[model samples]
Target: MIKPYFLTALSGLFLTQACIADVNLESVTLDNNPRVLKSIALLQSLKSPQTAMQFNAPYVHDLKNRYKVRSLFVESQNLPIVDIQLTFNAGSARDEEVATGLHGIANMAAQLMDEGTEKYTANEIARAFERVGAQLSVKAYRDMFIVKLRVLSHPKKLEPALGMLMEILNHATFKKSSINLILSNTQVGQKQIQENPSRMMNVQFYRALYGKHPYAEPISGTQRSISKITPLQLKQFSNQFLVAQNMNIAITGQLSAKEALKLSERIAGNLKQGEKAQALPEPIDKSSFDIRHIASDSSQAHVMMGHLGTSRFDSDRLALEIANQMFGGSGFNSILMQELRVKRGYTYGAYSTFSFSQVPGTFSFSYSTRQDQLLSSVQVAHQALIDFVTQPIDLNQLAETKAGMLRAFPNNYSSNANINAQLGAMGFYHQAADYLSQYPKLLEKINAQDVQNAIQKHLHPERLTLIVVNDQLDKTALETRLKQDLNPQAAQPLPTENLPNILNPPEKEVIDLPVSFPTDAPEAI
Candidate 1:
C-alpha cells in the first residue's frame, strides 16, 4: 500500500483544486449574463439522457413438431453461443396447502437430475460441462421451474449439451438418498433464514396477506413440503402440472434464426401438449384487514406492510409501475427512503415495492429501524402510503418516475438471462408477447392524473396488513398508535396463531433458563 503521508498529500492536492474552483459572490454575479445563461442551457441540452431504444430485430416465435415431436421456439441468435431453456409451471403453486413449498421441491428435484441419470453419472455430466465450458442451471421460482443450458459456438457440441440438459429436465430419478439429504440440508437453511427477522417478517406477512393465494406460499417452499416431497409425488407433479401449455422457452445470444428454430424443434418438440392455462385466483381475501406484530429477539425491527394491488393485465399496470418507483422502489428519491433513512436516520436503507403476480399482487413497504423507532417508522410509512393514494402525484416527480422506468428497461433486458426472465414473467402473467416492445409507448401514455387515479383504485393503505418484527416492543402502545392513525375499530391485539413457531419453542420455556446437564453427562441410554 502507498504510505499514509503520500495518500494525505494527494488528498490535499485534490482538496486545494476543489477550493480554487469554488464560486465567489462576485464570480456568480459576473457570470449571470444572458450569453452565459444561454450557453449553460445549450450544454445541458447536449448532455441529455439517451432515450432507451427497442430491439429493432423482430422477435420470431415458431413452434415446431417434426418427426413425431412438439416444441416451442423463439429464435433470436444475437451471439455465438446458442441457449436452450425449457420451463414448466410445476412450481409451489401446485403444492397442497400442507405441501406449501412444492415449487422449491420441484426446483431441488431438478438439481438432482444431473447427479446421476440412467445413462450418465454425476461425474460424467460435470466433466462434460467442464470440457466444453458449457453450463446448465435449474431453478424454481414462484410460477415456474426453469432449465437453462448454454454451449459453445459449435452447433454439434451445442446439440449434445442440449440433449443432456433435456434428459435432466425431462426425466430425473430424484434418488431417495439425494431427496432425504436435500431435505436435511434444507432444514438447516430454513433455520438460518428464519433467524433473520426480515426473512421471518416477509414470510409471515405473505401468509397473512394472501391467506391461500398461491402467492402466500414461500418461493422456495417450506420444510414440511420438502420433507414429504416423495420421489413418486415429484414425478406426478412434473407429469401433471409441468406440461407444455404451462411452459415458455426463450433463446438469446449466438445462433441464426433458422438454427434457433431448428434447435427449438430438436429440444421441446413432441413433449405432449397440454391445455391452455387459466388465470389464477386473485388475493381477493381482502378481508385480511389486520395489523400483526411478530416479536423476535432482535435490536431493530423488520417491517413489511402492504395490500393487494393490480395484476400485469390491468390497464393501470404502467401507472402503478411509475407509482411504485415514486413511493419507495426508486432508491434515494422515494419518500419512504428519504424520510425513514435520509432525514430521520431510522434505517440504513428503506424501500417499498409492489409485487404483481398473475392475480392482484401485494403492494408492500418494508424497512427496519431501532426498536424504539419501530412504531414511529411504521406510522410514517403508513401515512406516506395513504398520502400517495389520496394526493395527486406532482407532474415533475411523475415524469422522473416514468423516465426512470423507461430508462431502466434496456439495462433490465441487457442479458439473455434477463430477457428470458422478463419473458417468463410476462408469459406467466398472460401479458402480450409484445408488452416489452410496447413498454416505452405504454409508459409514455401514463399521465399525472392516471397515477393518482391508479393509487386511488389500487392502493388501500388503511386496509393494509402490517407486519412488524421487533423484539420486546410495547405492544399496547403500538396498537394504540395504529388505532389513532388508522381506524379505531381495526386495531386488534396480537393473534395467538399469527406468530410462527420459528424458534420451535415457546418464549416462556426457554427464557433465562439455566443449563443443567446431569452432573455426569447423560449416557447414550
Candidate 2:
C-alpha cells in the first residue's frame, strides 16, 4: 500500500496540474473583455496629471519646561488614536571604548523597561496595556533610544497607558533574571547572524569603512561584549542617559494641544534633569579602497560598495537625494537596476542609498548574484556610478524623480503615528522649525544642473571601498578578475583572519582585496 505522505504529495501535484490545465486563455484575454476596454477608455480620457501638489504642513506647537524637557505637539483631531514618541540622546555612539559593549546596556535597559517596574510585574504591565488596547515599542539605534506608544485617546484608555509609561520610565527594575534572559537571547541572535551572509557582509563592511569609529562597532554587542554586560552597568546607563533634559517627546492625535502639553509635562516632571550627550569625535575621512570577501557555502555573492557620505547638515543634501533617485534609488527606473538586472539579468535587485545622519554617514550600492557573476555585476555597478556623475542626467528623468518625491511627501504626515515619528525625527536631528514646510519649495527649485553639482560635490566613485561576500570556491577567480577589472596598485589582499570577529571563520577561507581607481582616471566625482 502507498504511504500517507506519498498520497498527500501526489494530491498536491495533481492539484497544481489541474490549475494549469483549467485556464481558458481566450476567455481571459483582455481583447475578449468589452467591460475592460470601456474602463480603460474612461481612465485614459481623464485630465492630465497634477503638476503641483498642495500640502498644508502640520502646525507644530513646541513646549518646554524649566527642567529642559522638550515636547512638540501636532494636533490631529480626526483620529481617535494617539501616538507618542519619546527619544533620548543616548545611543550606541556613546558606548565607551574600554566598555565597548556598554551600548548594549542601553539597548537591554530599554527592552526590559516594561518587563517590570517598581509597582508592577511584567505580567501586570503587559495586561494593563492589553486591556486598554495600547501598543508600546522600544528601540535602540546608533544615534538614539526610542520608546513609542499608541492608544485610544479616550480618558479610560489614555490615562492608564500614560501612567504605565511614566512608571516604566521612572521605575524600571532591571531585574537580574530579565537581564540574563535577554543576554542569552541576544547571544542566540549573534550565532544566527553567522548563518546570514548579507548581515555578515554588512558587519565587515562597516568595520572596514569606519575604522576606529564607534559607528564601526555593531549595534548589537559581540558575544564577548554581551556576556560582559551586567545589571549594575545597565542601571547606571539608564540613570545617566534616560533623564529629562536628554529627551524629546512628540505627540499627535485627537487630543487638544492643551491636553497633549499636560501629558508631556506629566511624563517630564517625574524625571531627573540631565545634560545632552557629548558630541562624538569626528570620523577620519579615509577613502582608501577596501574589499572584504567572507567565504560562504552559499551559491550566490553579496556585494556592497561606497564611501563616507555627507551629513544631514550639507546644503547639497536635497540635490544629492534627487540625483541618487535618478541613478539607483528608483525601483526599475534606476540606472543601476536597469543596467545590472533589467539588461544583464545578473541579479534580481540592485539599489543604492545614502544613509545620512547627524554625523557623516555611508552611501552604499548593493546587489547579490551567482558567485560566478560577481565580477561582472560589480563592474557594471561601478561603471554606472562613474557614469552617473560624469554624464548629465536627462531633464525628463529629473522632472520625474522630483515629482515622485513631492507626491509621496504628504504620506509622511498621513497618520497620527507617521506625523509623530516625523516630528520626533525633526526635533532629534535639530532640524529647522519650518523644515517640513520648506521641503516642497526646495524640491521645486532644484534643477538638473543643481543635481549634477550636488553629485560632483558629494559622491566620490574613485574613492569607494568595494566589498564582496561569496563562496570560497570562487576566491581564485575573483582575485584574477579584480586585477583585470581594477587597478593593481590599488588592490591589496588582506588576511582572512582580519575580518570582523562577529562572524565565524569560514569552513574554507576568505579573500580581502583593497581596490582603487586608475591614477589616470577622472577627478573624484
Candidate 3:
C-alpha cells in the first residue's frame, strides 16, 4: 500500500492535468476574434492630425554694409557657439568663364583655399583652429561656393577664427604642391567615377540634356578638364569670384543684433568688392524622346528618366512641390512607390525628384530592379507618371499631401545650424526676406487645379530622357514598349527608327583610395 503523503501528491498532479485538458482553445479564439477585428478597423479609420503645426519664424535682420556685403542674421541664445556662412555666387557653373576646358577650377580653388594663406602654413592654420576648439570649412557646389566657420561665442575664440578666415579669403596662396596634390587625387577619382554605373549614367544624361550648355558638365569635372587647371588660373578665378560684392553673409547662434552687424561689417571690409556673377543661360528643352543604355555587370538595372523642369522662381513652384510630394518625392505613400513596390513588388523603392536651382533643373524618377524586370519596371513607372498627369486630380489625396507638408515644415528650421543654412540659401537665391515666414500661407493657397495645371505644364511624358544601366538591353523590345506607353491611343506601333541611338560607355579602370582627412565637414548647399 502507498503512504498517505504520496497518495495526496499523486492526486494533486492528476487534478492539475485534468484542468489543463478541459480548456477549449477554439472557444477562446472564438471569443476574442470580434474584439481583434474591431480594434484593427478602429486603427484603420484613424486620421492624421487635422490641425496644422504653427511655426514661429525666427527674427531675421537683413542689412547691407558700405562695402556692398549683404547679410541675414538671426540671434539665438540657446547655445554658446556661433556659426557663420559666406555664400558666394562663384561655383562650378562659372568654371568655363575662367577659360575653356577648365571645368574644375572653382572646385580646385575651394579644396586649396584652406591649404595655406600668405601668412600661415596649412598645418599651422589647422592647429590654430583646433587650439581654439573652432572649425573652418570651404566647399563648392553648382550654384554657390561657401566658406563656413563655427566657434565659441566669446570674443577670444571668435576674433581669432574670424582673422584666419579673412586672411585665407584675401590671400590664399594656391601653392604649386597643393594644386598638384588635388589634381593627382582627382585623377584617381576620375577612374572611380567611370567604374560607377550611376555616375557614368549621370554624366551621359547631362551631356544629352544640356548639349554644350554650361550646366552640362558634372561639378567634379572630367580628367581632361581638371588636369589643365593651374595655380595661377585658380588665383585668377578666386580674384574674380570670391569677393565681397559677389557674396552674402549668414550668422546665427549666441549674439546680439548689434554684435552681429559689427561682425558682418568686419568680414566685408576685409575683402575686395568684386562684381557679382551674371545669370546662367537657361537649358534648352528637347522636343523628342532621348534614351540610352549603358552596359554594367551588376545583376540589377539602374534606370533614370526625366525632362527639363522649373526654376526656383517659377510661379508654379509651390504647386509642383505639392504634386511631387504626392506623386513620387515623398516615400512609400507616393504613387510611384505604391505602384511599383506595394502593388507589384518589382523594386525595393521608386522615387522622383525635382532640382530647383538658379536655372531650370531636371525633374527625374529613378530606381533599380533585377535585370530581368527592367522592361516591365520602366513601362510601369512611365505609365504611373502618365496617369498622374492625365487623370483627374484626386482632391482628397492632394489635401493629405499638403497636410503632410505643413506638419513637417518645422524641421526645415528646427535648429540654429539649420536656420543658418536657410538664411544662406535665401540670401544666395535672392528669395524675399520674409520668405520663411510666408511659406505656409503660400503653400496653403495652392489647390488641386493649381497642382494639375503645374504638372501638365512642367512634366512632358512624350519627350523624356531615359537611361538604363545593365549588362545589355533589348533595344527593339524597349522601343516597342516605349512607343505604346507614349501613345496608348494609337492604332499602330510607332516606328522605332527615330529613337536616338543607344550609347556604349567604355569601361574604366578602378582605383581605391583611403580616407585620411576628417569626414565631418558640412556639405555644399
Candidate 4:
C-alpha cells in the first residue's frame, strides 16, 4: 500500500532509532558499574616522576664604587618584566644608641622616598609609574631597608622608571608636610598596636629577652620618639646609612649581565660614599627563667615563651631548624600542635620558631587559649619543649622531619619576589653566594644524632620566659599550677603598669589659652 520511497525512509528511521537506543544503554551501563568507574579513576591518577631542584647561583659583580650587585637573568623572551631591589645595611639596628629615634627616622625616610622629589610632585611621580604599569615599594626590616622596583623591560618603560627611581634616591625632598603626615600615622599605628594583646605580649617578651640591646626597641619608634623626629634628622640619616658602601643590588628577570651592571652602577653612583653602619652588640641571655602576666580584658589568653637563640652564623643552624620543625614549627604533625590541639584540646594552634638575625636572635613558642586554660596550656607546651630537647628523636621522626623541610625548600624560591628576598637576605647577612645552592645538601647531611645534639646544646627549655596576657587569669590557681607543674621559685607576678609603654604616653589634657599678637592694639599699648 506504500510507495517505494516511503518504505526506504521508514527503514532508515528505524535503524537510526536502534543505534541511539544502543548508545543510551551503553552509557547507563558505564555509569552504573562501580568497578568501571573505579578503574577510570585509577587510570586518571597517574603522576609524573619527581625531580630534584637545582639552584643556579647569580653572577656577582663589584662596581667601581665598591657596591656589590648580584644579577640573575631569567630568560623569558615571551615576557618583558624586570625586578630591581637595592638593599642597604641600614635598619632599626643601626639607629644610634644616643639617638634611638633614628630608627623611626630611617623607616620614615624610606617611606618618603616616593612622596616627592625636586623634579616630580608626589601625584606626578605616582602617575609616571602607574601609566607604565610599574610598581615601586619600600620596606624597612630589622637589619635592612629595601627599595624595590618592577617594570617592563622595554626601553621606553625601563629608562623612565630608572630615571624616576634615581630622582627619588638622589633628590628626595622629604617635605615638612610629608614628614608630619608620616609621624602622625606612625603614632596612630603604635597606639593601635598597644591595644593588641598579642602585640603587647611580643613587645614585653622582646624587652625581657633582649634587655638593653637595640633589638628590644620596637622597629616602629615609640610615640614620644616619633613625635620628636624632624625632617633634617631624616635627611641626615639618609646621608649616613643609605650610601654606596652599605648597599647591595639584586636584579632579576629579563635582563642581561651587562645591562644589570650598568643599571646597578647608575643606581649606586649617585649615592653618597659614607661609611658602613656600626655592628650590633651581642644580646645577653637572662640569668633565670621568668613568667610575666599582663592583665587584659580579653577572653583568650596569649602566651609567648622562649629565650635568646642562635645567630645566622651558628654552625648547628640547619639541624636546629629541622629540630624546630618536628617540635613545633610543623603544622598539625608537630609535637606541640599534637599535644596542645589534638590530644588535650588546650588551644587552637601552637607554634615554635627560631628567628635568625645578623646577631643572636630569639626562639619563641606561642599559643592562645581560653583564659581559664592559660596556665595549663603553658605547662603543657613547656613540658613538650623540655621533652623534645631531652629525648633523642628516633630515626623515623628525623627522616620525616628532614623530608618535610626538603619538600618545602624549593618553595623558598618559587617566585621572582621570593628569590629576590632570599638573595637580599644572603647579602645582608653576609652569607656565601653559594648558600642557596648548598642549603638542601646541608639539610640532607644532617642525621638524627646531629639534630639531638643541636637541640641539647642550643635549646634550654628550663630557661624559657613565659608571658601570659589575660584578664581572667586566677592568680591563686596560676600559682598552684606553677608549684605543681613548674618551679614555684620562677613564678612572679608583674604589674600591668610595668609593661612597656612605648606606644602610649601618660594621659594629658589639652588646655586652651588666649594668644597675644605683636600687632594687637591692647597688648602693644
Clashing pairs in 4: none
Over 183-223, each residue of candidate 3 has an lDDT whose tens digit, in order, gives 78988888897787767777777777888887778876777
Candidate 4 error regions (>4 Å)? 1-78, 101-103, 472-525
The local distance difference test score of each candidate is 0.64, 0.74, 0.80, 0.71
RMSD of each: 11.5, 10.1, 9.9, 13.6
Candidate 3 ranges with C-alpha deviation above 4 Å: 1-53, 491-525
Candidate order, TM-score descending: 3, 2, 4, 1
Best of the two (1, 2) by TM-score: 2
Give TM per candidate: 0.78, 0.81, 0.83, 0.80
What order do you get sorting by lDDT, best first?
3, 2, 4, 1
* Worst window of 10 by summed lDDT in candidate 3: 512-521
Give candidate 1's TM-score.
0.78
Clashing pairs in 1: 69-270, 70-269, 70-270, 71-268, 71-269, 79-254, 80-254, 92-103, 101-221
Write one digit per residue (lDDT tens) for candidate 2, span 1-525.
999999999999999899758854434545667544445444433544553436887888886544556788888889799999888987666666326545466567778889998789999999999999999998777777888999999999999998898888877888889978987898779878888766776777778887888777676667676667776777777778888888888899888878888888887887777677877777776654566777777756778888888776788888988988888788889898788766766666677777666678778878777666676667677767767888877899899999898888888877777788877777787766567788889899998888989888888866777777766535455545444435535644321222221134323332322112111001101
Off by over 4 Å in 1: 1-78, 97-104, 274-279, 474-476, 486-525
| Top-TM-score candidate index | 3
Q: How would you encode candidate 1's per-residue C-alpha lDDT over 189-256 as one tens digit per residue?
A: 89997786766777787788777677676766778767677777776666666556667666666666
What ranges in model 2 sit over 4 Å off?
A: 1-53, 64-66, 101-103, 473-525
